[model samples]
Target: MSLREACESGKFVVTAEVAPGKGTDVEHLLKDAAIIKDRVDAINVTDLQSSVMRLGSMAFCHLLTDMGIDPVFQVTCRDRNCLALQSDLLSAWALGIRNVLALTGDHPKLGDHPTARPVFELDSVTLLDVIGKLNSGVDMVGNELKGAPDLFPGAVVNPGADNEAAMDLQIMKMEKKIEAGAKFFQTQGVYDLDAFEKFMKRIEGFKAKVFGGIILLKSVGMARFMNKNVAGVFVPEPLIQEIKDAEDKVQASMNIAVRLVKGMKDLCDGVHMMTLGWESKIPGILDEVGL
Candidate 1:
């Protein structure tokens, strides 16, 4: 079944991310794809994730599609204007890649190339509006396209905001995205179920399918690094302490990931696993959670 069907069927869908490397070689990408091919409902190919340049997400998604894997092609506005974005959407549709995730991506400075120029021509919210227009056979400027594209559009949300007001504002944005044309939502890394529950409570009436994001914490040090550097992601103090207290960090990390996935299964429509560089460990996580 397609990711859209799997999500709309009210089943707990499982999706994972695969970052194409900085080079043209797709060996690692295929290896990681093979690891979770059967386990996940679909694979998300990140677009220059973290603003760092790499093999294009469109190319990687096409590669995955050729290998008979369903791929959610992630498109970010950080690198493309509406023209290029719309063109890419049509290209993806022509190639039989249907699932898409729209993001306002991290700023260029946050990535490896610090001196790179930034582009914010259209934020994610406006991007959603653009997609809506395209779906209706119109371009961004209100001109009709020769042939419109039908995309199963999705957007990103962050439930781990530090302040209640900020969290509430994020939910408001999510509602707007759904109104604009978002069929589903894939959230940022969620560590606290209490926060997620609160966020979900506010959007209980909305119709979009929500997939909670779960990052596989590699170690206590990794957790600390993210806490210090990443925005909108918080590793709860207790979970961090548990990792810090473990004698076997690898086993501890795996246990933490499993518990999070199992616990989140009942709370959301699905889980988007961010294994970071540890894609090989996904099977173990799924096995532990009985997924």
Candidate 2:
């Protein structure tokens, strides 16, 4: 089923991330996509995730669709200006990619190519508004379009933000995205259920589906690195210790994901599993969670 259908059905949905390789070679990525095709409601193709350069999100998304997998093409504002952004949206629709995830993207300074120039002409909120305009059969400047694509747009939120003020800012931004036509949300990595539950309560009235982001922790060191560098991501002390004490780090990570996804079944509509290099482990997690 399509991602939109899965969300509208009110059944617990499952999605996974597929960050394409930096080069043109996609043999490994295609293999990974094939393994998880039947397990997920959709696969999110990241757009230069972390601001590091890679194959274009739109191209990989099309590749996934041709391989009989559903893709939520990620659009980042850091690389494209308004003209390029709108053009890509139309092109994506022509290619039969309807699901989209809008992100402001990471700063270039934080990526591998720090010397590269960054573009922030449009943030995530404005991108949602652009999608809304396109869906209405119009361009950004009010020009009529030949046809409007029925795009199911989504945005990201950071429910696991550290400070109360930062968390409040995230909710306020989420409200704006919803108003701008965000149909769903895929949140930042979630490690604390209590914090996530509180976030859900705060936004209980908003009419949007929430898919908790689950980034499988491979080791205590990995968790620590994210806590130090990644914004709005914190790996609790207990979880870190659990992985540190486990006999098999990979299996421990999978078990941790299964437990978290099971617990989140009642709190959110679905999960956006982000396994990065561990894409092969997603089918195992889904099977164990009985999805």
Candidate 3:
């Protein structure tokens, strides 16, 4: 079944992300895809995730589709203008790629190539508005399109933002995205269940499907790095202590991920695991959680 159908069925859906390598070698990519293909309802192909230059997300999605895996093509606005974005969306639709996750993308400075020019022709909110217009048989500027795309578009949310008012800001953004034609939302990595619960309480009236984000940390250093460098993501001291005290960082990381998933099972419609480079451990994480 399609990711849309799986999510709308009220089932506890599971999705994972795959970051294509910088080069053309897709051996590890395919292996990771195969590992989670059966366990996840859909797979997200990250578009140059974290501003690190890599293979294109659309090509990765097409490859996943060929492997019989449903892929959510993650489109970022950092590198493309409306014209290019629309052109790629048309290509994705023509190639049978249905699921799309629109993002404003990380600033070029955060990526590997810091000198690259940043493109902010449109933010995510504007992108969603464009998608809605396209669905209605028109482009962003009200130009008529030869055909409309039947895209199951989704958007991102940062549930871990530190500001007391950040949650409200996020909910407001979500409402706008929904009005602009977003059907589902997958959040940034969430480590605090209390924060996430609070965010959900504020948006209980929205009709969009929400999938909590879970990132698997390989070590305490990694967790610390995220806590410090990644905005809108906070790792509680207790989790940090747990990681610091563990004898085996890898096993401890997996244990923490499983616990997070188990705790979030009843709180949200689904979980989107961002395993990063540790994608191989996903099966073990799912097995531990009995998912």
Candidate 4:
């Protein structure tokens, strides 16, 4: 089934992240995608993930679509103006890309180009609204369009916020995104299932499909870095220690991911596995979780 159909059908959906290369060398990227293409309902091509410059997501997503794989084109609002953003969306539709994930990406200072200026012409919430406009045969400024893109749009939410106020704000933003025409939501990386259960409780009665984000922890250092630097993501001490004490860190990471996926399967409509550089591990993780 298509990702949109899978979400609306209330099935236990699964998607994985595919990061583009720093250059035009897409041969490796396509090869990696082929590994998990059949294993996932759709693959999300990240837009310069981590604010680092790379191949554009739209180009890579088109490649994935040409390869007969459903591509969820992730559009971040950090690098493009409203015109460029809208133009990209229309182009994506013309190229047969149906799924999109809107995001207010990381600042450029946090990436390879520390001296580069970042553009925040529109945030994710506003971008979601723009998608609705395009779907309704209009532009952001209410201009009529000759054709409209029938997009199954989604927005990101952070269920793993560090504090109560932050969590509440995340829920409020979720409400805005849904009102702005978000068909589904993909959350930030979640480790605390009990906390996520509470988050679900607060968002009860909402209609959007929720997908819990799961990032595999490769080592104690990685876990610590995310905990300290990554907003809305906290690696519980026990999980960090699990990696620290493991004889085989890779296997330990896979086991932890499987545990998180199994725990979230019942509460969420889907789980988005983000393995970063370990894309090949996704198929194995899915097999272990029986997804």
All candidates: TM-score: 0.95, 0.98, 0.96, 0.97
Clashing pairs in 2: none
Q: What ranking of all candidate models by TM-score puts the best one first?
A: 2, 4, 3, 1
> What lDDT would each prediction earn against the true structure?
0.88, 0.92, 0.89, 0.91
Name the regions of candidate 3 deviating beyond 4 angstroms.
none
lDDT of 4 at 146: 98
Model 2 TM-score, 2 decimals: 0.98
Tell me the tens digit of each residue's lDDT in model 4 across 1-291: 789888877889998888998999989878888898888889999999888999999999999999988899999999899999999999999998999999989999989998887899999999999999999999999999998999999989998888889877888989999999998888889998998998888898887999999999988888999989999999899999988888999999999999999999889889998888798999899999898
Q: Least lDDT summed over 10 consecutive residues: which range in candidate 2?
A: 160-169
Per-residue lDDT for 1-291 in model 1, tens only? 889889878899899999988999999779889888999999999999998989999989999898888899999998887789989988998888988898988999888998887787988888888888888999889998998887888999988877878877887889889988898888889888877887788789898999999998887778888898887898988998888898988788888888888878878899999988788888899998888
Per-residue lDDT value at 157 in model 4: 94
How many angstroms is residue 159 displaced in model 4 relative to the true structure, after the best TM-score fit? Answer: 0.8
Best by lDDT: 2
Residue 114, candidate 4: Cα error in Å is 2.6
The runs of at least 3 residues in candidate 1 whose Cα sits more than 4 Å from the true structure, single-residue gaps closed, are none
Worst 10 residues of 4 by lDDT: 1-10
TM-score of 1: 0.95
Colliding residue pairs in candidate 4? none
State the lDDT at 283 in candidate 4. 87
